[model samples]
Target chain A: MSTKITNKEQVEAFLESYDTFLFDCDGVLWSGTHLLPHVVETIELLRSRGKRLIFVTNNSTKSRKAYTGKFAKFGITVSENEIFGSAYSSAVYLSKVLNFPKDKKVLVVGEKGIEEELESVGINYIGGTDPAYNVEATDASLASLARDESIGAVLCGLDLHLNYYKISKALLQIQDPNCHFLATNIDSTFPSAGRLLPGAGTIVGTLITSSGRTPVALGKPSDEMMNCVKEAYHLDPSKTCMVGDRLNTDMKFGEKGGLGTFMVLTGVDKEETILGTNPLVTPKFYADRLGLLYELLQNN
Target chain B: MSTKITNKEQVEAFLESYDTFLFDCDGVLWSGTHLLPHVVETIELLRSRGKRLIFVTNNSTKSRKAYTGKFAKFGITVSENEIFGSAYSSAVYLSKVLNFPKDKKVLVVGEKGIEEELESVGINYIGGTDPAYNVEATDASLASLARDESIGAVLCGLDLHLNYYKISKALLQIQDPNCHFLATNIDSTFPSAGRLLPGAGTIVGTLITSSGRTPVALGKPSDEMMNCVKEAYHLDPSKTCMVGDRLNTDMKFGEKGGLGTFMVLTGVDKEETILGTNPLVTPKFYADRLGLLYELLQNN
Candidate 1:
């Protein structure tokens, strides 16, 4: 059973319970371009009380550097190290955790963000946003595509230009058991421009079905992402709280990592989901919205 | 236990047992563009014996009409009605089984073959091979994509030009619980041009993940397809035998339909697969290749 925080005392107690806070951006803080009410003030309030804040997102379309600009638009100050997008986390997972071969290159099935992050981590890669893959696959063109044995890993993320040509090449490379199949995240849908669009998981699902192989997902609800963030920030799970909207990804991620979880109703899940008889996951604490904590703290 | 058809007596007994033969064309009759050894003679022998022949393939890339031309290329006589492609089966399934509304249209996430089959069935459709979906998905363009209430179903097949634009449109229409989600076939991989390429299942998998909905697959191994062919030809399951190269699809299709199954080692599966302790689907009879039956029948 999960507790529903209602009053000012509950909010204060919740805030005092955790020294570090991990936040999910898209639904909790904002939905696409517009920021949610009291989000900026809530962050300011957390900052004033000396709470450590880290922005963690499963969106792999943007790199950490690009994400800084998104925060800047919302009048929020965020450094690269303060944020952890799936693209950057995947890069870290490859370099630090897997210790990917220095010589072998990664075949990217994504966009510029994955490429930028891989480059930042000193990893060699090809095929992401490449002009050659943009063209339609022809018999002549497909025959020209032989397996590149040099590719040690296939990293997939959210790609706007996903085509059969890319998937065909990915299938050939992933046929080798020696080659690693990796996905930045397996988010089924991403809220973008006020609509739920197909996320990275949809793109990765194509390869999985075709290749008959499962990938090592390196995002939310996976231990790889939690371990990467924990090691980098040196945060204590006992004192850290994960605040997000989605139950499957955000709440499950927090529970799996042994951290306190707080759920908000602004995103994919509703109150009925948690209050339902058979909920997918249970959060330690939940509120109508993230802004409620800030509203309750207002000097009334 | 399956009986391995070895001598002339066994081959003669096999031929005498079945009045109808359902053949999977891709790996059985031919590999790619070239006819397999003795395939012509075997079909000719079957015809001379007054056996009913039907070429049933899970490949949805080509319609039955197009398949007739391929047979003509190999100097074999085949009519349109003698063939059953997944593309045509899906159309029939939608019209006869589901009784899709005449006013409603289908949103295609496939190729021209599906379009041609849908047209043959007098089903109105949009999207497949449409220039509108051939472009990249941008915020400006996607914002213009409002749900079309008239689309009653979303059909998926093997599409070489599959793009994010088409998928985004599919996710929107499929979100309406009233709209049906249909797939021509869910073949994971298809051998093409001397290589195994991703199949219709891979394309449908993308929509399945994003929409979080399973489609009513109207192809091999599904009772929908078996019923369609069985009713069309008025063939008895006991007198019919399914001849093919794959176990999971071809063999399973035969077993589930209560028809005799013959496994040929010319394609996906091998003797070891069936001879193994836990075979996916065991055929009633096995042969090294389909050509062996023709060779055995030639002798005294």
Candidate 2:
């Protein structure tokens, strides 16, 4: 797993391998409220190198128009096709793998992102329940789909008010061995109120905790959506190096599925990760942000 | 489960009837730092009411003397005898029960608090391997007793470094069923870096996740230490109201166990709770702090 970087020079020498790059949005480009300094330049530098680029974020809370608006405000110029989020990934995956029945009805257990994805794929969705709070069954209550095992798969995503009851229902449905447990992402927590708030990951963890089985992850680190990326682009994996700050999505996407992983210290990994935890899974090359990639290429 | 309140008084009225009050400390008092202002006064008022009070915290990190000193500074007075930390609870249960197979020794999964408790109970202990971050089985790594079937039990407490290897060892010693799987407490997480640090509750949750069995909780909500309080004070439960902030421990202790639960807002329960949640399993009477209790009683 060690992508041998004999030195900084060797890593710089091998920059021309990938024709396309996939970047993660959250930890790579910006955290919740701030963008990395070199984010805009990073994309331009890659484009100048004759490389295709896409910003893939698993967060479904924001739509493409919203993301585009946000990125434009950050002075990053990109086309609508350049941004691929989990909502698109889920929609694309479902479109290919198992065509929902003509009258497909899904009990939505997530937020707006999930609802839109299912709708695009020709599945009818039960309006998601309000965010649960103040109940023991909040976990169970969140997975409204679990009440009816007839639902083929429970599409998992972020739920703010996760509790035991929703977890109980999801676990119960999964125990039937007939139901599929598809989680949007397994990020343990997300930043909220300037404090880490329990995200889809914690709820997914609880479901797995109760069911004793890992979910079929729809977002990052799972190959479930990579096929969509390939099909959408009509491109080969060998020509792409995933570049992002988040390990679970971008880095894992690159490393696990046979692409180069470039970790920028800018976003998700944080200052704490400068000293790597899993060295084998470490980035092939890192820069302060995308702007430095241009300077390195020029020096080479 | 409603204690007959003839007047317009609330849950505190029932709690005031108890002669000997048991409290769960961690979530009930302070989440670790920043003492709730009324905590000292609440306990003082209870004492003034001739209530025999005990401070029972499930956290096994600190010793009895340590807590007694800390509380003294906050203006609440208590001796080492009045505190029952999970560390102390674990020791009491072991000494009275299996006794760790005499000379065979036992591995300790906790910190100095655990060591002190064991020594006080005449039980010998040693540190375990890798000293996992799992919060439970913190003592499972005890190299002195890990492979030894002669070791009667793997005594677990609040070790933050608990992990998978420890769980494997417990299963490895499955032939010796009497070799107990004792846990000090089942707190899901502790407050750390202002985020949820996985607690012994997560560790035990993992065990029940892996093995599908519940380990006997030896802390405040458990019958073991409550019996310890009963034995020590010769107290009557019907007259006892357990005042605490955390719902699962302090509140549940009084409510489910046939004691009136007084939930003070000063601890773990939220101000949003007054809006509605299970206030029965919550506190019968709610107060901003212990002072409110004093004011209510003093004015009456």
Top-TM-score structure, candidate number = 1
Please give, for residues B1-300, the per-residue lDDT of candidate 2 as tens digits: 223223326435555566777776655565555665566766766666677887778878677878788777666688998887888778877777544556765566555787888888788765543334222222223222234656666666654433334544443343256657777887665553233344566545544443434666788678876766666667677887787776666777766667766666655567576446555364666556655654555454
- Enumerate residue pairs that collide in model 1: none
Query: Who wins the lDDT comparison?
Result: 1
Kindly report which residue stretches of model 2 are placed more than 4 angstroms away from their true locations once superposed.
Answer: A1-15, A127-146, A161-172, A191-195, A246-249, A268-280, A295-300, B1-300
TM match of model 1 to true structure: 0.97
- Give lDDT tens digits, candidate 1, residues B52-115: 9999988777889998998999878989999998899999988898898899999999988899
> DockQ scores for all the models shown?
0.82, 0.03
> Candidate 2's residue-wise lDDT over A165-216, tens digit each?
4444454556556666677777655553233334566446655654556777
Reference-based lDDT, residue A298, model 1: 86
TM-score of chain A of each: 0.98, 0.80
Candidate 1 lDDT at A55 equals 96
